[model samples]
Target chain A: MTLLAKNITLSYHQYEIINNLDLEINPNEITAIIGPNGCGKSTLLRGLTGLLMPAEGEVTLDGKPLQQWSKKTLAKQIAILPQNPSAPEGLTVKQLVEHGRFAHQGLFSKPTLEDAEVVDWAMQQTSVIDYQARLFNTLSGGERQRAWIALALAQKAKILFLDEPTTFLDIGHQLEVMELLKELNQLHNIGIVMVLHDINQAGNYANRLIAMKQGSIVADGKALEIITSELMKTLFNANTKIINYQHNGHQKSYCIPVGI
Target chain B: MKTRTILRGPKTNKRFYISVFALAITLVLSLFFSQIIGAAKVNITDFYDFFMAPNESAAQKIIGNLRMPRAIIGMFVGAHFAIAGLLLQAVLRNPLADPTIFGVSSGASLAVIASIFLISAIMPTTTFLTSADIPIFYVPFIAFFGALLATFLVFWLSWEDGNVNPKRMALGGVILGSIMTSAVMAIIVGFGQAKAELAIIWMAGSLYGRSYNNLIPLLPWSFICVIATLAIIKPLSVLRFDDDIAQSMGLNVKLWRMVAILISVGFAASAVSVVGPVGFVGLIIPHLAKLLIGGQMFKLIIVSALLGALLIVLGDLIGRSILVPLEVPIGAITSLIGVPIFLIILQKSGWKLK
Candidate 1:
C-alpha cells in the first residue's frame, strides 16, 4: 500500500513544528530519518501515520485520505510505536501484544483463533516468544523494546513506523533492533520508517536515508550519496570524517564526528 | 502446539481462578452475614424464618425492612465504587486514581448536599427525613451532573500542553475535594442542629436505615455501568498504554477516554448520591483486586467488583455490630482499614504515570 503526505503542515497549539512538507513512503524499503533535536522528525512521522492531523495538507493511504478512512481501517495498513512507550503495570508481554488485535476484534467479541495466531507469530518473529509470560516491567530494556516491536508487528500492518526505537538500548540491543528491522523489510516486505539518533546506524542499516534540518528535508537519497561531511556539517554544525567500507560484499559508509 | 487465547489474558494459573472463587464466596457469605449481624440480635433461624415462615416476628420485620435493604445497598455501592475506581485508574493511568481521590465523589457529594439544601430552603417547613417533601429519586441524577463537572475541572487543571501529568492530577484532585467538602459542610451547618445529625451520618457514609428508595435509584446505574465497562474492555485496556501507542492501536483515544470517564462517573455518582460519600472503596479496592488477580482488565474488573462488595458489606456489618447500639459509620471502618494498607502499597509501588 502506498502512503503519501501531500504538503502537510503539523503544529501543536498554533506553533507549527513541520511546515508544508510532502513525503512519499515506499512500501517495501527501510527508510531512516536522521535529524538533530527539534527538527520535526518525530512530528513528521506522526503526521504521516495519522497520529497528528496536519493543519494544511492531507495524508492518504492507498489513495484514500486519512481523515476519511476509519481509524481501524487505517490501522490495518499502518502501525506506529512511539518513543519510550510504557505499558500498564503487571501487563505481561503476551497480554501487551494481544492489544494489537484490538482493531481486528469486535468490541465485545472474544479474540478469535486467527488473532491469537498472529500474536504468536509476532512474538516469535521478535524472538520474544519465550518472554511472553514475563511481566513487561520485569524485562530488561532490550527485551521490553523487542516486546514493543512484537506488539507493533502483531498489528499485522504492512507499514510500521517507529520514533527513535533504539534509544535507551545498549550497543548490542541497538544492533539487534536494527537487524530485525532490516530482516522484516527484506523478508516480509514490511515498510519500516524510523527516526534514528545515530547517523552511522542510519547509514549502515537503512536502504534510503532522509536528512532533515529546520523541519525540511535537506537530503533524500541512498546512504552512500547522502553521508557526506558537507551534509553532516550543514545539518548538525559538526565536523565529521566519513569512511567508506565493505561488509558482506555491500558498500557501507560510517561517519565519526571530529573534535575541532 | 498449544494455542493461547487472549480470553485468559497473558498468564492464568490455578491461583487466579482460586482467588476469584474465594472472593465470590466471601461476597456471598458477607451478604448473608450482613443480614443477621446487626444490633437486633438475630441468628440463622431468624434469617431462615424471614425467608421461609408465614407468620412474621419483630426480628423478621427488621430483617425484611432494615437489614435486607442495607445489605443490598452496601453490595451495589461497593461494586459501584470498586468499578469506578478501576475505570478511573485505567483512564488516568495512575495507580492511585479513584473516584474519592480524584474528586469525582466530592463533586457528587457537593451536588447532592447543595440540591438537598436548596430543596429544604424552598420548602422551609419540610424537614430532612420527610419522605413526602423531597424528591429523593433525583438525587443520583443530580449527583451525576455534579460528578461530570468535577471530572472536567480536575482534567482541565491537570492538562498540560496536550497531555495530563499524574502528579498534577492527584494534587489538583486533593485541592478540589477539600474545597467542595468545606462547601458541603458549610451547607450542612447552615441547616442548624436539628437536621445536622442525619446529614453528618449520611456524609460519614453509614448504611443505617437505608431502604428501597435508595436502592432503586442506584440499581440501573450499577447494572448499566458495569456492563458498559465490560463492553469497552478492549479500548479500556488499550488506553492504559501511551496515548500515541493507543491511538496507533486503533483506539480513538479521546472518545474512549470520555466513555471511560462517563462510565466511571456514573458509578461514583449513583453510589455517592445513594449513600453519601463512601470513601476508600473507590481508592483501595482496585489495588486490592490487582494484587489478587493481576492487571488483566476483565479479571481485574470482575474481581474488583467482588472485593468491593465484600469490603462494604463486611465494613457495614462490623460498623454496626462491633459497638452494639452505637454505630460506627461504614466510611470510618473503610478508612481505618484503607489508610494503612494504602501507605504500604504506596511505599512499595513501582508504577509510574507519565
Candidate 2:
C-alpha cells in the first residue's frame, strides 16, 4: 500500500510544474506536502492522483505502475478529495457519500447492503450522519468540507490524497479534520498525503512533512526534525520563530513566520 | 419496496411524489384533449370510441390518422428534446445549456433540409421520375444523416486535447447551428414553390403525414439512447462533483463525457428526424422537472422525458385546434407556452443555477 514517484517531471504547455521530483509515502503515516504558492505542491498531488501524466518518470502503487492499473482498481486503493469540490444542487450528504462506491459497483449493480454499510460508516466517522439528509449547498463551509471527506472515506481506500483540505476552514473545523485524519491513520492504517497551506497545521498534524521549493523536495523527514528555522527560512524565504509546548501531555511544535 | 426505503429522504421523497402527480395529470389531460381538439372538433366520448372501435366516419379517420399520430409524435419529440436538454445541462454544469444551445437540433435540421429540399431538387431525374412516388421513409434517413453530421462537427470543434470545456462546446454549437440554420433559411427562400410546403411542415414540426413507418425507425434508436442515459445516471451524479474527485473515484471522465454527448446527440437527432426542431420543450421541461423533482439523474431523466412528452403533446393540440383549418406550428406553440412557464419557475426559484 506504499506509493512511490521516481524522478517525475510534469509540465503544462511547456512550463515546468514538477521537475525531476521523487517522493515515497509509507503505508501508515500522515504525510503533508507544503510549499510556497506556485511551488508545485498541488501539482505534485495531481501527479500522484493520475490527473496529470508526468512528462517523464514513473508513479507506482504497491510496486505496480499506476498507468497499468485500471482506473477502478486504482480508485479502490486510493481516494482523493479535491479542494472546494462543487456538489450538484439538491444532493444530500448521504447521496454524495454514496458516490464513492462507484468503483466497487458493477455496471448494473444497485447499492448493496455492504455499500450502505460503508457509506454509513463513512458518514459516522466524519460526524456527518446528523446532516445526511441536508442538501449539500445548504451546509456551512466546514460541514460541507467534512461531507466531502466522508465521501472519500466511503471509498474505503487504503491511501487518500487531499488537496489543501483545510484552506478555507475555521480553526475548529481544521483541527476536527486533522484529528480525523490522525485517527484514520492510527486506526485504519490508511496512508494520507495532503497539501497544506498552514505550516503550523502541517507541523502539528503530519507524521512526515515534505517541503517543496521550485519543483523539488527541499526537506522530507519527521515533522519536528525538518520544521527548523533554517529549513523554514529556506523554503518560505522568511524568518520564523519555533515554539515548543505540551498539549494534553503530547509534545507539539508551532512556527510563527515573520513579515507574513 | 426495499429500494424505496433506501431512497427515502424528505426532499427526494417530496419531489418524487410531486413529479409523479404532475406527470400523471399532464399525461392524462394532454392525451384526452389532444384527441378531442383538432381542425374539426370531436366529442371526448366519440374520440374514446374511435380508439376502441373505429367506424367508417371521417371524424374517426381524422382522429385515428391525424390527431393521434400527431400527439404521439409530439410526445416522443418533446421527450427527446427535454431529456437531451437535461443531460446537456448536467454535462455542461450550466443552467442555460440545452439541445438548441449545443446546436444539435440545427445541425440535424441542416442535414434534413439539404437531403429533403436541396438534394431532391438538384437530382430531380436521378431516382424517381416523379416526386410523388418517392419513398416517404427516405426523408427521416436523410434527416438522421444530417443530425449525425452536425453532431460530429460540433464534437470536433469543441473537443481539444482530451478536454470538452462546456463554454467551448456551447460556443462551437452556437456558431455551427447558426450556419446550418442560415443554410436552411437560404434553401427555403431560394426554392419558394417546389419546397415551400415541405419546409413549412418541417418548421412547424407537425404530425400531419406521420405513419407507423416514421415511429418504427426512430423508436429503437431513441430507446437505446434513453437506456444508455439511464445506465450512466450514477456516473453523472458523481460527475456533478469536481472532475478531479470523479476521476479519483474511478470514473473514466473523458469516455463517459463522450458517451453522454453521443446520447444527447442521438436522441436530439432522432427527434428532429421524426419531427422538425421543436424548441423550448428540451430547454424548459428539464428545468421544470428539476424544480418538481430534485437533481437525481435517474429521477430527473424519467420526469424530464415524461414532462417533455406532455408539453409537446399539449402544444401540438393547441396548435391544431386554436386556428382551426390553418394549424400553427408545434414549435411556435411550445415556445409561446413554455417560455413563460419557465420564466415563472425561474423567478420562483430565484434562477439559482446549481
Candidate 3:
C-alpha cells in the first residue's frame, strides 16, 4: 500500500507554506519528516494525512481519492495521533484507547468482544497495560504519550501518522518511543510516517528520511545516502561535519557541527 | 482479569443498573413526598378519595390544582435543565458551561419581564393586576423565544473560522445573560410593588404556581430533545477529543457540535420557558452523575438524566417546605445546595480543567 500526494499547495490564510510539493509513503517503512520550526514539516504531515485539504493538487491513499473514501473507511485504513492531544479529565488509559475502536463498531452499539481484545492488545503492545486503570491526567508525560499511542494502535490501521510524537518527551522516553515506532513497522508492517524535529535521531531510527527547508523537500532517501555534509549545509544553512560509523555491520551517519 | 479491574464490563453494568434502580426509587419517593407535604395541609384520605371519586373539597382542590402540577413540572423541568447542562458541558468540554451561563435563562427572564411590561404598558388598567391577570400561557412562548434569541447571539458572537471556542462561548453567554438579567431588573424596578414582586419571583428561577398549561407545551419539545441527545451520544463522546483527533476518528466534529448545540438549546429553552430559568441543576447534576457512574459513556449519559430529575423534584420539595409562608425558589435552593456540593467535587477533583 502507498500514500501519495502530488503538487500539493498548503497555505494558512493566503500564506503559502507547502508549495507544490510531491511525496510518497510506502508501506511497512518508518519514514521521518524533519525540518526546522517554520519549515512546514507539521503542515506537510497534516496534508499527507488528510487533516488539511490542499488548495491545489490532491492526495491519494491506496489508489482512491482521499476525499472520496468515507471517513470511517479511511479511519480503518489510517490512524492519526496529533501533537499534544488532551483527553477529558477522569478518562482512564483504557477508555482513551477504547476510542480508537470507534470506527470499527456499529453506530450506536457498545464495544464488542473483538474491540475489547483489540484494546487489550494495543495496551500490551505499548506496554501501558499496567496503567490502564489510572486516569490519563495522573500519568507522567511519557506514559501519557504511550497511552495515546496505544489508542492509535487499537485502531488496527495499516498506516499511522504522528506529528512530533516525541517533542515533549525526555531523552530516554524519546528513544523508547522511537524504538517502539520501529518495532511497530517491523513486526506489524504498519506504515509509520512521523514529523520529528531531531535530525540526528531521525537519521538513526528511520529507514527513510525526508528533509524539508522552507516547505520544499531538500532530500528524500535512505539515511546514509542523504545525511551528507553538503546536504546539511544546504538544508539548515549551517556548516556541519558528517561522520560515518559501523554498528552491527551496518553503516550509520551522524551530523556534527564543525565549530567548538 | 484485565477487564475486571479496568473496563470491568459486567461489574460496571451491574453498578449502573443498581444506581438507575435506586434513582428511579428516589424519583418516585420524591414525587410522592412533594405531593403529600405542602404549605397547605391536604388530608391524605381526600387525596386518595380524589383519585377514586371526583370531589371539590379543600384537600382535593389543593392536591389536584396546586401540588400535583408543581411536582410534575418539577420532574420534567429538572430533567430538562440537567440533561441540557450535561450536554452543554460535554460538548464545550468546559465544566462551567450551563444553560444559565449561556444566556438562555436570563434571556427567558428578560423576555418574560419585557412581555409583562409591554402588555401592562399597552393596557394601563392591567398594570397593577398580579401575573395572574397577565395571562400565563404567553410567558412560555415569550420565554422560549427569548432563550432561542439568547442562544443565537451567543453562538453568532462565538463563531470563528467555522469553529466555536467554548471559552469564547462561555464568556459571551455570561455577558449576554448578565445583560438580559440587568434588563430584567430595570423592568422590575420600572413597575410598582405587586408587579415588581411578580417579576422578582420569575427572575429568581422559581417554579411557583406553575400549572399543567405550562408543563404541557414544554413536554413535546423537552422529552423529544432529551431522547435525541441519546442519538448523538456516539458523536458527543468523540467530541471530547480535540478536533483533529475527532476528525481522524471518523467524526464530523463541526456537524455534530451543531447538532448537539441545537438539541441542548431546544431542551434548555423549552424547560426555561416553563420554569423561569432554573439554575445549577444542569451544572451540578452531570458532575454528580460522573461521580456515581465513573464516565462510562452510556451510564454517564443515562444516569445524568435520572439524577437531574431526582435533584429537581427534591429541590422543589425542599423549596416548598422550608420556610412555610415564604417559599424558597427552587433555583435559589439548587444553587445553595449545589455550591457546597460543587465545592466538594472541585476540592476532590482539584478543579483541573484538563
Candidate 4:
C-alpha cells in the first residue's frame, strides 16, 4: 500500500519532463495534482503507475522497486485510467469492465464468479449498471468516462490514478464525477490520485493538493493552505481572488481568475 | 430482481450460438458441394463408392486423389487467411488490415517468382517447360520464408523509439507490398518467358493440382497457429484498445503484440505457400464475421474461421466448374463474390471501424 517515487526523473524522447521528483502517495486519501499544460502532470502519473520507466530514480511499491514486481502482481494493486481511452468496436460496457479482471484470471481460464461479482459491483458503484449492455461507443461523454472508471474499479486495486477525469465534461457532469470520486474515497477508503486541469475542482474535492510548475512540485499541502491568489499567480500566471465559504460544517475554497 | 436478472451465468449470447450453428451447417454443405460439383462427371454416389468400395474407378480416383485433397486445402487455406486477417486487424486497430497489408502475400509471390527465374536460368534447356519441370515441391517452402523476410523488414522499418506504431506498420506494409510487387513484375519481364506462365498462375492464386503434398505440410502449421491464436485471445482483445491502456492492465503490450503478429504470420505464410495468395477471404471474411457475430474476439475468430473456409471451398468449386475446361483462379472467384457480399453487409449493418 506504500507507493513512493524516490528522486524519479521521467523523460520523453530524450527530453526531461520530470526531473528528480520525489513524492509518497497516501493509500487512503484523495490527492489532486494541479499544473498548467506541459508541466508534466500526466507524465508524473504515468511514471508512478509503472506505465513509464524513470530514467533516474525508482518507483517503489511496498518498499520494492517497480521492475521487481511482475506486471500482473503490480496491477493487482494499482489501476490507471488514461484520458479518452477508446474501446474496440461493438464492445459493451459490461465487456469493457470485465477486462479489469484480467490480472485476476488465468490465461486460458474462464472468468470466475468473483470476477463477475466485481464487475457488477464496479458498474453499480459508478452508476453505469443501467448501461452495462450498451455499446461503449454509443455512450455520452460523461457516461463513457463513468464506464471507464467502472473498468478501473473492477480491477479491485487499492489505488486508482486518472489523468484528467473531467476534461471535456460539462459543469454538471464534472461535478457528478468529482462527487463520485469523493464518495469512493470516503466510503471505500480507496486511494485516489488524479491530474486535474481545473484548479477549482481540485481545491473543492481533493483532500491534498500538489501544485506544480515546469515539472517541479512548487507547493504540496492541504487545499486551504496552498490554494491562494499568490499560488494561482505562480502556477498559472493569472490574477485571481480566493473565495472561501462554509457548507455543511466544512470549509470550501475556490479562486476566481480575473486577469492574466 | 434487477441484481438477480443481471447476474446471469457465463454462457455466450444467444446470437453467438445461432451464428455458430448457421456457420457449421454452411461449412458442411460447402464441403459436400465442393466434392460433387467439379468439372468431372462426379455425383453423390461416387462419394460413397470411393469410401465404401475398394476397387478404384476413374471417377473414384479423381474423387479420392484430386477433389478430396483440393477441397481440404481450400477449406484450411480459407480458414488460415481469415483468422490471420482478424489478428492483423485487431493488433493494427485498422479495419483495412489484412494478410497482404503485412507484405505476406506479395513477398511470397516475389520469392516464388525470383526462385523460378533462378532455376530457369541455371538450366536453360528446361527454361520454358512450365513449373512442372522444376522441383515444385519446394515452392511452398520458399514462399514461406519469403513472407517472414518481408514481414521482418516491414516490422523493423516501422519501429520507432521503444514501440511500434500500428499506423506506421500499416504504412510500411503498403510501401513494402508495392516494392515487392514491382520487383516481381521486373523479374517476370526480365527473365523472359521461362516458367512465366506457371508463375502467373500461382500469382493469380489457384488450388489446382494441390493435394496431400500441400495439405500435409500445412496441417502442423495450422494446428500450432490456431492454438497459439486461442492462447493469446485475451491479450488480443485487450490490444484493440490504446497501447498504454492495455499496458496499465498488466499486459506486456509489446511482447504480446509480437507474439500475435508472429502467429498471424505463421498462418498467412503457410496458407499462401499452398494456395499462392488468395486475397479477399483474409481481407473480407473477418469483417463479415465481425458484422455477423459482433467483435467479441473468440466469437469473431470462430465465425471467421468457418465463414472463411466456407467461402474458399465454394469459390474454388465455382472456379473450376463454371469454366469447364478452363479454370478461374480461386482468388478471382473470392474477390468477385466477396466484394458484393461485403458491400451488402456494409449497407445492412452500417458497420463502422471506429
Best by TM-score: 1
Docking class of 2: medium
Q: Which has the better TM-score: candidate 2, or candidate 3?
A: 2
Candidates, ranked, TM-score: 1, 4, 2, 3
Better of 1 and 4 by TM-score: 1
List model 2 lDDT by residue over A30-96, tens digit each.
Answer: 9999989999988899899788888899899888888888989989899988878888766777888
CA lDDT for candidate 3: 0.83
Question: Cα miss at A29, model 3 (Å)?
Answer: 1.5
Worst 10 residues of 1 chain B by lDDT: B1-10
State the C-alpha lDDT per candidate: 0.87, 0.80, 0.83, 0.85
Worst 10 residues of 4 chain A by lDDT: A129-138
Clashes of 4: 0
Clashing pairs in 3: none
TM-score of predicted model 2?
A: 0.93
Please give the fraction of native interface contacts (Cα pairs under 8 Å between A and B) kept by each candidate. 0.69, 0.71, 0.46, 0.56
Quote the positional error of residue A41 for candidate 2 in Å: 1.0
Clashing pairs in 4: none
Candidate 1, position B176, lDDT:
98
Residues B1-354 of candidate 4 have per-residue lDDT tens digits of 476356332334778898899888988888888778877888788887777874668788888789889999998999999999999988888777888767888888788777767776776644322344456566656777898899889888888878887778888988999899889878877775745666666677789888787687788889999999999989999888888788778788888888998888889888887788788777788888876766688999999999989988889888988879889999899889977876886777566754
The DockQ score of candidate 1 comes to 0.60
Query: The CA-based lDDT of model 2 is what?
Result: 0.80
